[model samples]
Target: MVLSAVLLFGASSVTSLNGVFAQDSVDEISESVGDTVDNAASDISDAVTDEESESTTQEHGEMVHDDEGRLPGNIKIEREPTYKVGDDVQINATHMPGMEGAEGTVIAAFDTTAYEISYTPTDDSEPIENHRWIVQEEIAEAADQEDADAPFEVGDEVTVEAYHMPGMEGATATIDAVNETTVYLVDYIDTESGEEVINHKWVTEDELATLDGAEETAPATSESTTESSEDESESEESSSDEESGSESDSTPEENSDEESSEESTPEESSSQDSSSEETE
Candidate 1:
């Protein structure tokens, strides 16, 4: 009876110890799972914040293209485009501020080499990266002796002669891309300022969409240019009239001075004669 009692007590003790170790392992696993869930939630929250920050930062800067008047190189259009020159189209490209969804007039259309370049602005602003649409004509030759028509490949460093952007006229840029396509020069109203922009250069064909029954609203020479020429002519005429008036006003003063001089000479001669007669 004593041996059986001892065996029973040992079995009970072993079972109790086993239960305690099993409970401890379950608690540890639960703690580990809770910590993993909390870390995963924290990581997701951080990722969402980073995405929002990146999106918010994109709105602060502007990407601008050349707006100088188009210069045609000896390039020919290989295919018919959906929109031709003089067609009024809506611009979908937002390269510059206030450009997206604006009405644009297609002033020029040609096939040429368009380049993506990086340059420092002449105004001493921050260096612009991957700027679009500096055409082949806009790049200056490195050497006067070299051929001006030489094609530039990606990574060729060259000086820009184009005044499309501030500080772009003289800065050296590296070519990033070379594309051969139909480029259009356009005129558009600025959406933000409600100001008219005319003869703005170099929106590619892909950037524009034709309106239904679009007529030739854009002229060969923009009306803005015609008005500008007239204003300049009027200014020149005004300047010429002012110059003629100044000459006329000075003429009377010159004549009065001459008359007074002539009268004084006669008076002096008579005085001398009277003195001689008195002496006689």
Candidate 2:
């Protein structure tokens, strides 16, 4: 009977141990399925994020607008783009953030045809005039030019109908302003201390930030020219007046001498007449 009881206890213990092992296996299977589901959800989330990013980038029409026309930090510089090509138009908007006040040169104007060109800006140690900005498009060039007989001014906006940038052409950009003056295609070094910006990109007008009073100095020199001209005119007038005075003074002396000579002649004749009478 004792041997039988011991055998029974051992058999029960073995069965329980096996049952526990089977339970652990089932638990592991359940855990693995949960992990798989979690992984799938994570992958789906990642895909959604990627799609959103793509959608965002696909927007070529969306403008990053600043109502005050303030420039974003990404923009390194801003200036009025001289319309070296387009006809005169009103500046209606700003490009590249902080460019609302940027002046553009009207290279050409079209009645309904949008003027566009490609340029690579030689900036940032890279030859990149590739920055082509549409000067005018979808607007009456004649009408706009008639409006501003002088030059391009601020508050004008224009759309691009050409392909300068990926979607730049035909993509509308505002005319920051219109400026009529000498636009310079120039090369220069940046004044900013250490940007390593060998050739920076920015279209400037006649009246942006004055470096060493460049524009002002020109006017000052012009004023000096005017003053010199005026002085020359005055000197000429004074010379004429002096000549006239000298002529007048000199004529009086000559006339007086002539009168004295005539009077003396008369007196001498009279003296001769009196002597002849006395002798008679």
Best by lDDT: 1
Backbone collision count in every prediction?
Answer: 3, 51
Tens-digit lDDT string for candidate 1 (48-157): 99988776444332223334554644445535666766778988877677788889787767666678888777778789888777777777663352765456899988
State how far residue 95 of model 2 sits from its true place (Å). Answer: 2.7
lDDT per residue (tens digit) for residues 10-48 in model 2: 999999999999999999999999999999999999999
Clashes of 2: 51
The weakest ten consecutive residues by lDDT in model 1 span: 57-66
Q: What is the TM-score of each candidate against the true structure?
A: 0.47, 0.32
lDDT comparing candidate 1 with the true structure = 0.76
lDDT values of the candidates? 0.76, 0.44
- Top TM-score prediction, candidate number: 1
